[model samples]
Target: MKNLILSTAALALTAGIAMADTVRMGTEGAYPPYNFINDAGEIDGFEREVGDELCKRANLECEWVKNDWDSIIPNLVSGNYDTIIAGMSITDERDEVIDFTQNYFPPAASAYVGASADVDVTTGVVAAQTATIQAGHVAESGATLVEFATPEETIAAVRNGEADAVFADKDFLVPIVEESAGELVFVGDDVPLGGGIGLGIRESDGELRGKFDEAITSMKADGSLNELIIKWFGEGVPTYNADGSVVTN
Candidate 1:
């Protein structure tokens, strides 16, 4: 939470000014490529870069707040931060409670990975990070869902035989599977999920959301957003056209 030195009455007088001057960006610092604590104990990753750039473009001073994934949304609602720039997908369910900027990322797939390609994901035990879209999908897909509070724990469950497979964002799983050295392999078809990742904000902060929305629009129009996407996620990932539509192979 941000600290303001004003008395209650004074704060009420300048609430909008305070909201515009300094913004707190919240994220699950455990999710890599989106966010993670570096060896130096500071936040680093794709979202870090994007958030900083967006803040610069929007002419806002911003600081990052690390929070556990399971409680990220609740904290946002309780005013722990001014915005959620985590790799949060734009979903109707979440939108009911908060507003989202236009997507900065193209739609991505959720994938299943197991010890082998033959492992059944349809009816077998599946691990997913709690409070994620993937977990909800697993629960409704007839797979026995075992949820963990963190993404690392979900992967650990699969490794320790607690789960037959782990389902999560394909971008997150790709590097893990590669480094697993054959211990883990992709299984089942990729499932497209959500409406792409966007900045999450309180519904009441429409002005703040609009600032970010315009900044994102500028990035997409100038192709810098696509450059950052390729820089972090590598080639072959979907990118945006000049007109802001997705360019997929």
Candidate 2:
């Protein structure tokens, strides 16, 4: 079933691997190719590997618990889990609540609209080092903006005129646009909004944090991370290149 460990991932517990080190993990088993439950009910994705590596580096055991994305943080805060491996974006706002390891993956957020639309959205300030997609509709002059808590809600709101356009990740928006009843299109000329994702845990779990960072270093150094990105995102995601160079702008 593709269990994460071939052997206990080299336990890295501070005073030696903790005997009670069954680290509880939180994930939003919905984002496919990141951390989702397949039709066979097995949880798999890039973040899944991150969890596995962390356990090995920390010399701990893992117990992954799939939860709704919205509820993930609350559960962790309330002591329901030990770490969060969801493709959660690391922002100052989130940092206020939890600590993060160095980012294992950096994801780009984009807007999407219907396939029938002819809007050119790539006209925002261009950076010599980045690409960007746009939100399909322009905000009404001086119109108030409302941010949705989840990507799905944002897309639905745009379709209903409850909002003008949605800003979301490509992974979530692309599939939604294909089935949207309204014109589901994103702009192309907007500024690239990127804040990528990282591992999360309670602020007190410093032991786990060190382990996670170490594992990230190992995976990146060995090229496992780049291999996984290519396998999932079709070479679009910036992993690493054949010459050990960062394939990002």
Candidate 3:
């Protein structure tokens, strides 16, 4: 009877633990070094670190979900997960629908193109994150444009000579096209997409929102944040303030 009681108690404890676990979360499995799935089918990257830290701040459990870059928000709003831990930009447009935690890792904006060509300030630009802001600037200043997509696709385009350039997050590009040397140059960090990535929770989760903002700010100040950035982005890229202002190392 003693052995049977012990076994029953173990089962009950396990059930209780499951109930207390935090809600699910997700991100695109494409952005490398930032967030991607391992061979073991687990989500891992810089963003994973952010997610873990956010959960710790909120004192909530976490379970990572994986999906494409494009579908992250739509799925999130449909109740697929409690939040999107993806390296998603928080635009004024997006903010109208969902709430965002304070800026955690604000990657600088940089452009990439063929390893051989000069920076084409003439062709204007195209951005991976969308030109909703840059578009207005370019229209006012006058520039050129090409297609836009993931870095994988854009790099491939450059290789195939289909596109002239690719504007992207400076953190990832500094290393990805490193071999290209002159072929890939970081033209500028002037894009309108500022504020880096955010922890996207539902607008209604006010308590969770406050906790995440606190956690993110602390992580950045304590050096743990910079450690992860160096591990993936090397020592070149700068973490910016929310409005695209440069922050010193």
Evaluated with lDDT, which candidate comes out highest? 1
Tens digits of per-residue lDDT for model 1, 1-249: 000111111111112224657899998887778789999999998899999999999999989999877667667777888888778888877776667899998888889999989988989999988778788888899989998888899899999999999999999999999999999999989999889999888777888989999999999999999999999899999999988999995
Better model by TM-score, 2 or 3? 3
When summed lDDT is taken over every stretch of 10 residues in candidate 1, the lowest stretch is: 1-10
Model 2 lDDT, full chain set: 0.58
- Top-down TM-score ranking: 1, 3, 2
Residue 47's lDDT in candidate 3:
82
lDDT by residue (75-194, candidate 3, tens digit) is: 666667777776666666667667788766664564444445454645634333333233333335445545343557766665566655555555556566676756566554445355
Q: TM-score for candidate 3, please give it.
A: 0.75
Q: What C-alpha lDDT does candidate 1 achieve relative to the native structure?
A: 0.84
Error of 1 at 153 (Å): 0.7
lDDT per residue (tens digit) for residues 6-94 in model 2: 11122222221233579888887866667888778878887777677768777888888997765666667667777778777665556
List per-candidate RMSD values in Å: 6.2, 9.5, 12.1
After superposition, the stretches of candidate 3 with alpha carbons farther than 4 Å from their true spots are 1-20, 119-121, 124-144, 181-183, 186-192, 236-247
List candidate 1 stretches off by more than 4 Å.
1-18
State in Å the error of residue 8, model 2. Answer: 39
**Candidate 3, position 240, lDDT:** 46
Query: Highest TM-score: which candidate?
Result: 1
lDDT of 3: 0.59
